[model samples]
Target: MSITPRAAEPVDIDKYGPYGRPPSKPPAEARKQTRPGPAFPNRIGTSEYPAEPGRYHLYAGHPCPFSQRVMIVRALKGLEEVLSVSILDPMRDSRGWALREGEGHGLDEVNGFAFLSEAYRASGFEGHYSTPVFWDRTANRIASNDFQHLDTDVATAFDAWATREIDLYPENLRGEIDELNEFLYEKVHNGPYKCGFAPTQEFYDTEVRSLFAALDELDARLADRRYLFGDRITLSDIRLWVTLVRFDAVYVTHFKANLRRIADYPNLWPYARDLYQIDAFRDTTNFDHIKRHYFGTHTWINPSRIVPVGPDLDWEAPHGRETK
Candidate 1:
């Protein structure tokens, strides 16, 4: 469980910083240009990357919502002992997400790569380095960084090895889950980024409005049910909870997603707390990483790089959700 801390490999700080954007380019431009890493077939029965305990590992950062989603599913499905994980340091310098010497910040045990980008390069990937990487040790290369598919594959593909019987993506609910996921991705998952990284005033204005409109609709929908689909916590709930958990603490100010705090919403606030009470969701969330990453790394937005200290959250407080 312990990893020796070493200096990260040299990289072009300017080129790799700001999420792999050139200094001259706007944040929005970077968002537009950055593409998800290439996909790798990792199904349970597939020859490429089969479901085998201790054969695969997940490279993740606690601050990343995408990574958090995969981690949540891994825990919920009881794949923690089956699939290993190495968490990167929250702050990404020019060298990108590094493995600092410490207890929580773990080095790349699978490949011993100091920088995450090095792992990408070793796998013959020249694109932007992102986390939630699915590493297949038997092949000595990254299996996938396509987070959306990666999340589901980790949830369902390892059913044979999973200890828990909980199914987040059931066959009967696929249609409903997919529909809700698509809408949430555009409006909630990626909505805050669109607001924070807007290239112009016009763009920010448009995105913030759209983001709030979607939030309003979601809040109304949750007014009756305990979760998105019904009483059970599905993939839709996991996808949306990651965003909501960070909304008041980071997105409200840093991302300018301030139409209203998630706390302001009647149903959404309690719903978030209800999910937070679950160990799979709460334990994966690292507010320290979340706050530091946004405020420290995004110097273009927060030039002073000063992380705020207020906005205290009581996620463990009674949600009163059972009354509904």
Candidate 2:
């Protein structure tokens, strides 16, 4: 029993944006304090980016819930021919995370590199050109953008080319799944970007009342669990189902996070439609690149970008939660 260290909470480097909120800007090169290549060998087949089966690639951004939590742990550890992904072009501006050729995105076909800041300057990673970006393609560059440990390193570093080995960071629940994945990344996955990039109005009413008091205490602790550490599915339910599948399609009206809706959470809108009826969280959800990447890339919070259609969400209705 040895644990005592707590007193450091005062970071306000202009209150968010270096890879945090409001269309994350401020890093066009020259910020690197290390990140050039080869650091992320977090075990498995070991050393210098080992775990091979097509030697790593992921870039990801179906509207970035931290690249949909490592693309739902690389599609729940099937590891899609052992860790390969692309899917960028979710409408980011300030010239970042591009690739081109739409329809679930294209280009950057393993470092053809149209953008993504040229795969972070082709290895010499300057800084916040963030995405899922794990890329090593035979040591040509980045091993990780550290999407908070790339969903536990693609759910435990390619477990011998995981064709659905499905552990999702277990080992006796890894200290309560790293304390509910840091309280679901600080009160429910970056708590709607700290109430849509709050820098005023009493800090957006104290972060939208601590983000609906941590989503009303996880909708009463999932009103008797079916997931979030219960019957299966872990990594804290894929980091709270990629922010409840983009909280009413892009944080209820482009990150205004309109007070109440994850369909008004009666147990988190049927636990986010019972993890969107599974297929690795409904085929790694797109929602038109999560509603044109937060209403057309946060033009200082929607300057006539207009990508809304209606609430109109269904997520294929019935989420009975398998008789929880």
Q: Positional deviation of 302 in candidate 2, in angstroms?
A: 4.3
Alpha-carbon runs more than 4 Å astray in model 1:
1-45
Q: Write the residue-wise lDDT of candidate 2 on 1-324 in tens digits.
A: 332322122222233322234433323221211122333333334576667788777878888787888887877778788777877777655556667776887766555766677677877656568777777777777777766776786787678768777887879989999988887877777767766766566666776787788889888888898877788888888888888888887786776878898887877888888788889888888788888777766667776768988778787889787887
lDDT of 1 by residue, 1-324 (tens): 454445464333355665443334475564453344454534533666777888887889999898999999999988899889889888776678787655456666666778788777888867568877888778878877877777888878889888888889999999989999999887888889888877778877988898999999999999998998888889999999999999999999999999899999999999999999999998898888888888888878887879999698788989888856
Write down the lDDT that model 2 would get. Answer: 0.72
Candidates' TM-scores?
0.90, 0.33
> Over the full model, what C-alpha lDDT does candidate 1 score relative to the true structure?
0.82
